[model samples]
Target: MKEYLALFVIIAVFLYLTYTIASLPGSDGLPGNGGYISDEVWYVTSARNILHDFFKTPANSPYYTTTLDCLTNESRIVKEYVNINAVTVTGNVKCYIRRGFPYPDKEGILSYYNFEHPPLAKYVIGLMEAIHDEPLFWRIPSMVLGAATLILVFLSARRVTGNLWALAATALMIFDNTFRAMSGIAMLDIYLAFFTALLVYLHLSGRLLGVGTALGLAASVKYSGVFPLFGLAYLYGRRGVWGFVAVFLMAMSVFTLVNMPIAGQLGIQRWVHEILAAISWHTTSRPPGPIASNPLDWLCMHNSFALYTSPDIYASGTPAYLVALVYALYKRDDVSILYLSTYGGYWLVYLLGNHTLYSFYTTHFSPLAHILIARLLSDIARRK
Candidate 1:
């Protein structure tokens, strides 16, 4: 009964926080049209385009007024395109409706706007856009998932730490500017964070199948989701080699299934090209920007990316929070291994190339870090 009450408290607090975030002046979609909150331009716009593509909303259709389809594949040249609000351009890089596919109906999975990233999160945003195509509507999924993420953090942490510790950690997570900022936006990292926390919850529940599914969902949001699989497989390996392999196979199957909507439309040739193109885009580095930061910078809580101004929301960390996460390695347990693999995954990507990582990406670590912090605090309290 007490636990149930605590969960209610968590929900209430998050509801208040999410509301506060949404009420910000520019919390809507693009700048000038509503306001700027960073990547909402890309993710929200891509989601709008995906909604139009999946439904074949024609160029002449009145539904296009919802501002869903941002890019029309009329021509390769920039001037020939109808760029809605120009959300697709980032520095010199441009997002296009790909393969010379003539817009909505003729589009394939790989030809959709922002096809550089996987489609699951966009599909989620697209589904919401169908309701009304408003800015807040596109962000609803992220807000709900963000709330679910905190609840998952509490539940998963409660298994290993005191209820007070779990509750406190969950509260602190929402207060975290980075996590909070991501939580209230129409962006991809919040989905990735939710799945990562769900993975931990399922892992603790000893449900290998659910763990695999969560991993697939996470990877579907961003390629970095694949990193935790290595840690999970190793932990499962302790049971047997086959446990490891089953987790891997199940995750692969789930990932393929998640992409089936897009992949089914791609045919054989475009699917192959997409696979290779995605790999190259993720691995390759381009011009350094102000928002980019290194893993070391993240740990030190230095140089956080400024996602928005005025009612400022910075995607960043404090030195102590990251230190607590690092300290958890002393536990030498499954959670520790998971944290190592997930954070190390980012470091590995940085080392291999891809210097454009933003501080907002830290959303993925918030769940694992909070759980670790709860345990650390619980241990300290007991020692005292």
Candidate 2:
């Protein structure tokens, strides 16, 4: 036990160091820069609003427009983008300030902050605001939690298989620039990714309640986390239908409780309406920006906008990711196979059913992908 504990600590420290190094200036995906997407600013703004005003309506909403002109409009808050109100430099690097919520009044184009997304991620940033009162401060928790996510991966992998495979998986995830950049930010991706991975790890290890709670928390971070619940259904189906329903309801209950109070009963009904709006906006809401082109072309060219644009538009057509998922499902006996299927399934369901896909949307499946890729490489090393 002591040996395992020590190993866990070492892995945790290594993940923290690696993330910190990768997160240094120029690593964050900033706008107008190669590899830097513009969505990070929006997430930072949302996070700030959650901290400052958890109850009030958002202003300067990069996600949805509640202005009188668009209030009745069926528009999806696809990008959840944040409008940076100001940008300043302390020494050599420049820092940005996004227009956040809890504004004094809703005037002049609703240019404060509004609901582009659910409140959980912003709630996280709100926590940061409570502590640091600075943009970078919100990022601190993400870095720490992101490192902790890696540790969970390492430990889970070791328990599922062994140290050799676990170590390999840990190293691969640690070095992946996408994972590093996502973790380095104040966005909900890292938090969602970590909890999603943690939920899967627990379920595979035979901890049912942990899976439920973890998944609930994951969903709370972002709706994307709901994908894994489907995987859980497959795993639990053999036991009995009741068990599956029980756990699912437990997970949903957690999701509902967190969101209900803020949204109110009418808010629940509005979620569906908002979802439709987001979906419609996703396909047709191109407002003549750098990202107005077709998503297929943008994604293929490795463009920054491709990574940051709302999923509503980018997901309009069938993507190759669906084919990959079908192939993955055929190999569903392996846990890695399940991960791939879920990851692929998640993309397909959203893409085919909805109108767009975003760069961070890829993050929805990253936790499963990380584990599968790590384990696959570990197997390769052994065969060699």
Candidate 3:
């Protein structure tokens, strides 16, 4: 009963926090006062275009260009065109771009949408748009996924540590400004983080099919999810190659399925070409301007990315992460080692690869960090 109560309270708190943050006023492409910007404009609109094309035409109809056009128009509008500018009495002007709306000029020059990231997340957001084309609706998925992630974090921690530690870890994550901010946005990173945490939890439980499904879903949300495969393989390879193969096949299948609508429209050869082009664009893309920081800076919390201003949310866990690192170093337990290795593998990719890295990218590291910190606290309490 005590354990159940703890879980219940944690979940209730998480849900409350997530919903509150997600409900904060933001513009979902509708023109209005007090409208806030979001990356959802691109994702929600692209999903809208894809769904529109998917329904209006047959399954094999060319949605590639349509999706690309939607993405391209959104990019151009947000970057090149500014629709609204507000001036303060002090003679300062703040500019706001119109987002989350379909492209008005059909004849405008449409650049090929990069289609750089995987499509699963956009599809989910698009589904929300289908239900209700509102900004709040678009962000619902993130809020739900964020809450689910907290549950998984608690479960994973409880499995290795205790209920008290699980509760502490969940609370730490729940209160994190970065987690709260991401939970409220229509962005891919939060989804990626949720699936990644689920993958770890499922893997730990020895549920092979669930592992594969989680792994597949994670990668489908964002390619960065592939990083966890290495850690999983290394930790579980002693069982044999069959499990790894299952993970591979399932992940590939999910990836292929989610992309089939767009791929079928483009044909195999053209689809391959588009994917390679996206890779090239990612590799060659310039540094992420002044606001961006390298992997080291993110881990050290030297320069966390600012996601919002009015409430002052940054993509950072800071001293909490530092605490986790110290505890992991001291404990060296199986759970600690597993998370440390997985966390290290994920960060190492960013460290070696050259792309605009944001602090939010560190969101994936939060669950492991929380678990480790919880373990440390649990250990100290036991010793006392």
Candidate 4:
């Protein structure tokens, strides 16, 4: 009990310091700098668009046909050839007359963003907008999820090893400057980390049904939820057909239930149509600049420091890094660290090929590294 209390106090202090450091003029704002990034602009617009159903407000709408239609269209002459500035069309344009985002009032302007990622993220942002109608409001939930991710790390570490290591793991995640920033922002990556850790915890604790439900929620947040699904499938590969079926049904049921309201309100086909429209926007979206076109461009760009660095920097060293890490922990094969590494590494591979990959993509890898680093630290302590 005394040890747990001490751990809690230490964690609380780190969290406070983290928040304080992040609050420094340029910290709390978001993706690129103190201000929100382009993706955040889209997320905010999408959230506002969702409110069009209830309030008819267009303040944050991403569509060109809304508040800024005239300007969005006029400026769109340049947007057309610019690639990154292209607009997306949605069924909501006709049904709600809500128009496109960012450049909401323009007719031909379209978003380069696509719905392929998953609708749940938009729904989350939208729900927050419904309440506060502010970007900061939408950011609140991700912050909570981020803090919860730390709590889960602590708990999971204790379960896998013991309390001492759990406290150390939690501390590492709290101080890891990048994770600190990502958790405070409104993006989906932190949420993805939260869900991945959650699903793993539930599965380890013998709550298979909870694992399915959690994964479904995770999938709804981002396409990366598929990584957790794969992890579970691999873990349960030989458990039995019935086990697989039960898990699948639980996950699918939760996913469908959450999506039902949106599908019903928009019409199932129209909902799917908007989703497809979003996907097309993303895939065809133009490269931001030459520096953004290649993964190596990350090195030269100085302003947005977060966008450039990540575990991929270690890819060339994977033979020495991941290989060594794997061999050293060979005895912990049944542990969650292995699964976290597997899923995180899998995403890193996909990101390497994505010419559009940004800094936040590294969030996908942090949760896994958080645990393993703690384990490594523990191993060193034991040797000492």
Judging by TM-score against the true structure, name the best candidate: 1
**Cα distance off (Å), candidate 1, residue 222:** 0.6
Local distance difference test, per candidate? Answer: 0.72, 0.53, 0.66, 0.54
**Candidate 4's C-alpha lDDT?**
0.54
TM, every model: 0.84, 0.67, 0.80, 0.69
lDDT of 4 at 282: 45
**CA RMSD of all predictions:** 6.8, 9.8, 7.8, 7.7
Q: How do the residues 1-384 of candidate 2 rate in per-residue lDDT, one tens digit apiece?
A: 654665566567656754553344332322332122245445655455544355443333232223223332333222222342222112221212222322211122223233545567767666655554443565677777777777777777676557766666666665444556666556677788788778877777787777788788887876667767666777788788876787787787787777774567446667667656644553343444443322333224233233323221121212223332443455464455556644655455455654344444544555565555455555567799
Alpha carbon lDDT at 289, candidate 4: 51
- The sequence of per-residue lDDT tens digits that candidate 4 reaches over residues 24-116 is 323212223343432464555555555565335444433333222434323332112222333333223322233333332222323323245
Off-target runs (Cα >4 Å) in candidate 3 are 34-36, 55-114, 284-290, 329-338, 351-355
lDDT by residue for model 1 over 76-163, one digit each (tens)?
Answer: 2222224332222212222333211112211232234676788889888777766655556667787889889989989988999978
Ordered list by lDDT, greatest first: 1, 3, 4, 2
Write one digit per residue (lDDT tens) for candidate 3, span 62-126. Answer: 11223222343222222222332211111111321121233322222132232777788877876
Cα deviation at 330, candidate 1, in Å, is 1.0
State how far residue 158 of model 1 sits from its true place (Å): 0.8
Give the poorly placed runs of model 4, Cα more than 4 Å off.
10-38, 54-114, 270-332, 336-353, 379-384
At residue 132, candidate 1 shows an lDDT of 58
